[model samples]
Target: MFGPRRAVFLDRDGVLVVPQFREGRSFAPTTLAEFAIYPDAPSCVARLKEAGFFTVVVSNQPDVGAGRTAREIVDEMSLRLRHAMPLDAIKICCHTSQCACRKPQPGMLLEAARELKLDLKESFMVGDRGSDIEAGAAAGCRTVFIDLGYTAEPPPERPNKIVGSFREAADWILSLPQEDS
Candidate 1:
């Protein structure tokens, strides 16, 4: 019998979309106009899917909870993302405070694994933030950290791999040895 399916968990901002930067900190786009998906994002997701890995997006969008952005706008952005990529699932946590589903807690990744019937040990998490790396590690997934060189936020301590762009991240994942079916 086959075990649970493997997945690639991606952080929404910086990994797939061009994040808005203010005071050297990365932030999710509040308006649709500011939300721009990376040109390579769609193709990379397609490659992962074709490789038999579920492409899932796990993101933390705290702006909505902070009242800086409306939930409707966030939902619209999510809809646009779904239209742009062939993702298996997109899980988002909009909490401003420490919550079960927030990054660095691994709740989102764990929840996705349960709902998607994925194997956490066989999955990979790609992100550009420390919280993302921490979450992936807590969930027992290998991590890829995209180093965008943000000045305000320090780089994560350790990631399974580090790269410069989403394309590179995808390439690294593709280069890994696959387990026999």
Candidate 2:
């Protein structure tokens, strides 16, 4: 019999893709033309999947909810990402307000856990923002923060590890000891 599955929840912008930076802050690309995945992302995700971890993307694309960007464009970017990598799923929250599915709340992770039969305790969340860390921490998973040195505030909840790139994060996660069944 198999035990519960482990996962790595990745934040879309900054973690997997390059985010637009201006005035010392990070921003998601509003257009597909501006959207581009980090060169190392696909291989890093492949490494995690090879190590028996499910790779899921949990993102907050508020531009959609705010009507600044069309939902179809975001969907297209997701579809492109799926074609480029071996992701198990992508969970996006387009709400601009304080909603349950948004990060800092853990709704997306929790819902993924329930639907994917994931073992939260053994899972990990990798992101470049405070809310991502908070969400992972709240969902009972170890968090990895990719310190891009954005002008925004640091994660209020400490992450298990801090890395400079997705490659480093993947290496750190792979270095952990495996749990016995």
Candidate 3:
């Protein structure tokens, strides 16, 4: 019998979309107007899907908990992301760092694995931040860090691979050995 399917988990802002910047600070989009997807995002997602991996998105949106962005706007941004890519699922943690679902905690990836019946050991998580790497590592998934020279400190746990763009990340994931059916 086949075991759980392999999946590629992605981080939304900074990884899938062009992160918004305000006063030299990086931030997720607070409104639909501020949301902008990277040009390569669709193609990158499509490549992963075509390689027979389920594509999922795991994101941390702490602004919602901080009351800097409305839940409605977050939902709208999620809708746009889904419309823009062929993701199998998108798991969002709208809570603060204390929440278990937040990145660096692995709750989102773990929940996605449970819901999607994914083999975490055979899966991969790609992101731009250290928390994303830590989350993927904690969840037992290999990680790919898209290095965009962000100012944030590195993740405590190192990712399996570090690349310059999502395209490179897709290439790396596609090159991995396929899991047994």
Candidate 4:
């Protein structure tokens, strides 16, 4: 149960990866060779960890559902990230349905709460898309958006906060009253 308020949800693609260019209807990095992490993300997560926030990755990987990517590849990507940065957990919603685990849904965050014993109110979700924000807000956590300009349309629902980069969002969090803690 997410009780005493302790957790942060993150998205992997645009928020973490630098995001290679795509023509249309596709922009995700197609290979492990292409995956890259943001420079300041590690320190940002470290700060949250120092502040008693269990950082978890809440992502939607429908590639498995549609057969564009394999489950093992995605798992490897997550593990590669684990080696690259220190995160409490990496959660993925492989289903293509309106499943609760998807970004537009709160399933992954809720699942993280169940597994990690988080406090939803104290947690935050940082991602690069509107669904990422919606999921966090629906789960009752503050949301942050890292814009990559891939989204072709406006957000149907907005997040609690928006920032140009993860470091900016991290700086904003650090400026908060709880930063020093």
Candidate 5:
């Protein structure tokens, strides 16, 4: 029988839309007006889908608890995201860092794996921060770091690949040998 499908888990904010930072902390962007898609996101995702890979997004948004943004705002932003690039599934950690679901914890990735029956070995993560890479690595998925220049703590672990943008990451994937299937 076929095992779980390969997937590409992407990061929101700096990877998808513009990250809203306030008071030296990350904030959930408040509106569609505030959310801007990175130039290559739409096409990058399309290529991944075309490549026979399940595309998911795993994000950490602690805005409500951090008081940096509201839950409504975050929800609204998600709606906008769906309208924009759209993913097969989106898994997010709305709670604070201590929550098991938060990135750097691997709970979200674990949950996605359980719910979707994903093949961790065949999956990869493309994100902008250390947490995104760490989370993917912890879950045994290959990781790619998108260097969009967020000022978070340095990644304790190195990702399997580091690219400047989503387009580049997609290109890397497409350029790989086709034996992956």
Candidate 6:
């Protein structure tokens, strides 16, 4: 792996699909029936693939640890997401705020960088939350924050770019200077 490939690390819940909302808060789908892939997500991922980027999904599913959802359901969702899109890998953290692999920690992204032989500097992380941006920055990847207007608080850290949807995120990544292998 002398010349590592660049990756686009995606957050699953809000970035790939419409998150389930209740009482003004967003939650992951706990069941296969509730999993809904956004209309543009498949094409957005396809575009990233076409642009020579390895697309990986890094997600936090804390409900499983909290007993709000089952691990099987979470696994099912991951399977469905991978089946629906052109993802190279899916990394999930199911622990409730106590694990290093969760968003805001960069463990998952770091793991992917190691396992996939990725160049973090040439990578981009796309997510709709501050934790996602923080994790990407910690992992030394450029961050793309998808602003869905769900939070009043500013991002935990500044992102390299902020866009309104996954489509725009992919476009931004494509616009960057291509890294020479």
Per-model TM-score versus the true fold: 0.97, 0.96, 0.92, 0.89, 0.86, 0.93
Residue lDDT tens for model 3, 78-119: 888889889899888888756788988899898888888888
Would you list the rank order by TM-score, best first? Answer: 1, 2, 6, 3, 4, 5
- The TM-score, computed over Cα atoms with residue i paired to residue i, of candidate 3 is 0.92
CA lDDT, every model vs. true structure: 0.92, 0.93, 0.86, 0.78, 0.77, 0.88
Report the lDDT tens digits of candidate 4 across residue range 1-181: 2236577788888777666666532255657787778787788878877767788988888878888878888888889888877799999888977876777889899988988877788778888877888888899988887766655656536676778888887777666665322
Query: Model 1 lDDT vs. the true structure?
Result: 0.92
lDDT by residue (tens digit), candidate 1, 33-145: 99999999999999998888998899999999999999999888889989999988889899999998999899999988998888899999999999999999999999999
Residue 135, model 5: lDDT of: 85
Candidate 5 displacement at residue 48 in angstroms: 0.3
RMSD of each: 1.2, 1.3, 1.8, 2.7, 2.5, 1.7
Worst 10 residues of 4 by lDDT: 21-30
Tell me the RMSD of model 6 versus the true structure: 1.7
lDDT of 3: 0.86
TM-score of 1: 0.97
Instruction: For residues 1-181, write the lDDT of model 2, one tens digit per residue.
Output: 1655999999999999999998776899999999999999999999998888999999999999999999999999999999989999999999999999999899999999999999999999999999999999999999999999877665446789998999999999999997643
Q: In model 5, how large is the Cα lDDT of residue 157?
A: 65
Residue 118 in candidate 1, Cα distance off native in Å: 0.6
What's the lDDT for candidate 6?
A: 0.88
Give a tens-digit lDDT track for model 5, residues 1-181. 2544878888887777767775543544656577777777887888888787778888887766777767777777777677777477888787865777798778878887888787888888888778888888989998888775555556436788888888888888777764345
lDDT of 6 by residue, 1-181 (tens): 3345989999998899789876555678887788899999999999988877889999999989999899998888888888888899999898886578988999999999999889899899999888999999999999999988775556546788989899899888888778564
lDDT of 4 at 162: 74
Off by over 4 Å in 1: 1-4
- Tell me the spans in candidate 3 whose CA falls farther than 4 Å from its real position: 1-4, 22-25
Name the best candidate (by lDDT).
2
